[model samples]
Target: MTAQIENTGPLTTEAGAPVADNQNSETAGSGGPVLVQDQLLLEKLAHFNRERIPERVVHARGAGAYGTFTVTADVTKYTRAKFLSEIGKETEVFLRFSTVAGNLGAADAVRDPRGFAVKFYTEEGNYDLVGNNTPVFFIKDAIKFPDFIHTQKRDPYTGSQEADNVWDFWSLSPESTHQVTWLFGDRGIPASYRHMDGFGSHTFQWNNEAGEVFWVKYHFKTDQGIKCLTQDEADVLAGKDPDSHQRDLRESIERGDYPSWTVGVQIMPAAEAANYRFNPFDLTKVWPHADYPVIEIGKLELNRNPQNIFAEVEQSIFSPHHFVPGIGPSPDKMLQGRLFAYGDAHRYRVGINADQLPVNRPHATEARSHGRDGFMYDGRHGGAKNYEPNSFGGPNETGRALWQPVPVAGTTGDIPAPSHAEDNDFVQAGNLYRLMTEEEKGRLIDNLAGFIAKVSRDDIVKRAIENFRQADEDYGRRLEAAVKALRG
Candidate 1:
């Protein structure tokens, strides 16, 4: 539905403010090299100088592709979201997949959670589903976010990742047990980007036109099927080809072997969620399938490779807060924190009009806002009245276009945050450990020991083992034994 490139006139400053000269820097005198007081030269130089923003602290390395999402099953009863309203409607989408806890230069084959974020350009606007391969996270509360990220990042003293630092945080914050189990599992190191499930780990709210709200968790089941690399294979791949996952994604799309997933949602009614056994809004947990079964919604196919990696993929922005009319966020604390953090980061990195970037812009809807003339304004809203209540017609807010409001009732006072009922964070982890076959459990223990054994401090290693013991005695004992064997 896109038109060919039309003559948009000569390129100018980001604001469409015309520029007569940009090739040479202005100078005090023609013989003089340059002058600092030239505003135009300063604007161009300053912007060009600060063009690159800080890469994500985590999930820094990634690849993206353009695609379309086709509604294959009716989900109109659950969500009024147009992308899933009909059985045949198609919406343009862009999907970005990346590894978390790794730098931009890190190897793609490393054992870490893969971020699977998708931005759908629906008629309503952009809906960004920011998620990961795992269905759960390490922490529940937003308050612990910075401290938690610190452990995964480099050590302040050594300037490198330290097993002791990570374990110290994990053992202390017992809530991380569930996600830790998944991290050590075979799924942690996927063989390729194509062979893994993507989940909206946070429970979100889907509001119907009737104002009914449901707590929803999205699962994009890979049609390529789940495939994982063993530790040995992962190590070999890391050494042989650091960008294995990125290369795989680009090549697949280029060759027309498009990677696709069937979108499914596990939804819980709002009333039931109020009294559910577990905290429905907790990011570090999942709703059991028996309680809320998977409902198929649509299919997402990545059909087009990005023309320019830096312009289209590296600078692209995705956030959990970018919701359209039918979708809204839940009271999920971590999700709430990210709503602010992601947008704030984009503003810092790509400037105020990051949304104007072609990769981030909506496909069908024109952006209308009081915000004008930022670093990268695309001039799409040219000559249109920028202000509301204008003599000349300008875009106005539509009440019917608004999302169905979910009631927000709570005392405005400082209070202890809500915790999940029966919140023994280790139980589900123990269950996961028990479900693993003996061989799998052995590998898990070995993997834990492989990393933990690197810690120089004996106390740190013992403390980490104790944390595992809290989950399962056998788990702790095996890890301790493996560590000792590795030391020998």
Candidate 2:
């Protein structure tokens, strides 16, 4: 038999030339200062200085894995996306799970919403489904995003998170009522990344080959079941092992205990949006199952752990703008803003050629565009025409017709306004409150009161109580009582 080949190679500089010595810098004379002409030392130090990219403003702490998504049902009548067109079709995917408001070293078990973003490598292109653990978000409009995130972060003066800061913003923004209730509930602190559910959170549009359009919402229910930590349990985990979630995910995968989720979608006919009880595009609400039942589509299973955290996880970028054919955006204000924000943030943090990074690169199809010449450009388009409408046989557009646009009859301006007549903010929140069990409602009240009681400002506390009152009388009364008792 032929000798087994070993691919061991010598170390070299980034320029690919073999290095003579890596352990020492060039010196002027024996025991003298290092020489400035040492190109290897200069190059090594320069690269080390820039080895780290800017961390994400949010979702900074994350863990990722490689997986496969297999379609179990056919929904071709609603969408023409090739990846979901046939049962048994499989798409390779990279999924990143993160804590939304945490830093790179923050405790994973802290009470916070988790990010569940997936990059699907399909024949059409890469489709990124960037979502969160919670089905509803804190605010509906993108204008409130920065301010809202600020509240979730540290106080400028104190350099630490203050209850006053968080409560003041939430109380002032009544749209936050629905999500606040969810946040303080048991689901706020997931037991592990494998045990929580994931949602698209925003309504999306799906178009069939016949040109029929339908509104859609995605839900990934964890096969491991919904498990959450009590405040006491989470606090203990935070102190004992801040990286508990990351360790659990990595160890489980290594032990061959892969986690999985059932993929389902709630689809609404395009024309019915006009007459729907609530705005279909509202990120703060969910489509009631009575009206639109979930249709089972596929399953997502994470079977492999990433070999390199920075290369496969940190450099991977997911954006709402990344979509395959027949799958498009909706009028959700938050989603609309994210289509631009996510990509822009990636470019700024990871470099203009972020898409060329191995983890973020498209595996199924080559990306074609007129864009060229940026930092770390990778020089892939050798001798290819860089512009459209050229005599040279460059890549041409598909010439496909655009999706049908919904009619718009409102005055357009920079100011944000309600999208529908029934856009009352408190109704769905009240409905959600009433849907919970007695024990859960009690826990929610206790959680909210405990957090709000820490706010020094009475006015903020009262304003927050009023918003809760609008959601449900019992909810507000219990919270008010709980806060008073805590103060006593």
What are the lDDT figures for the candidates, one per model? Answer: 0.86, 0.91
Model 2 agreement with the true structure over 1-488: per-residue lDDT tens digits: 13356877988889988899998899988899999999999999999998898999999999999999999998999988999989999999999999998888899999999999999999888999999999999999998899999998888999999999999999999989999888999898999999999999999989999989999999999999999998889999999999999999999998899999999999999999987878888888888899899888999999988888998898989999998888999989999999999999999999899998889888988898788989989789988989987888988888764344666786778866455656677878899899999999988888888899999988999999999999889889999999989977
Model 2, C-alpha of 19: deviation from truth (Å)? 3.4
Model 1: which residue pairs collide?
none
Please give the lDDT score at residue 475 for candidate 1.
87
Report per-prediction Cα RMSD to one decimal: 4.5, 2.8
Model 1: what TM-score? 0.88
Best by TM-score: 2
**Model 2 Cα shift for residue 41 (angstroms):** 3.2
List candidate 2 segments past 4 Å from native.
1-7, 28-30, 414-422
Candidate 1 ranges with C-alpha deviation above 4 Å: 1-51, 400-402, 406-416
lDDT of 1 by residue, 132-216 (tens): 9999999888888899889988989989988888988887888888898899887889999999999999998888878888889
Error of 2 at 478 (Å): 0.9
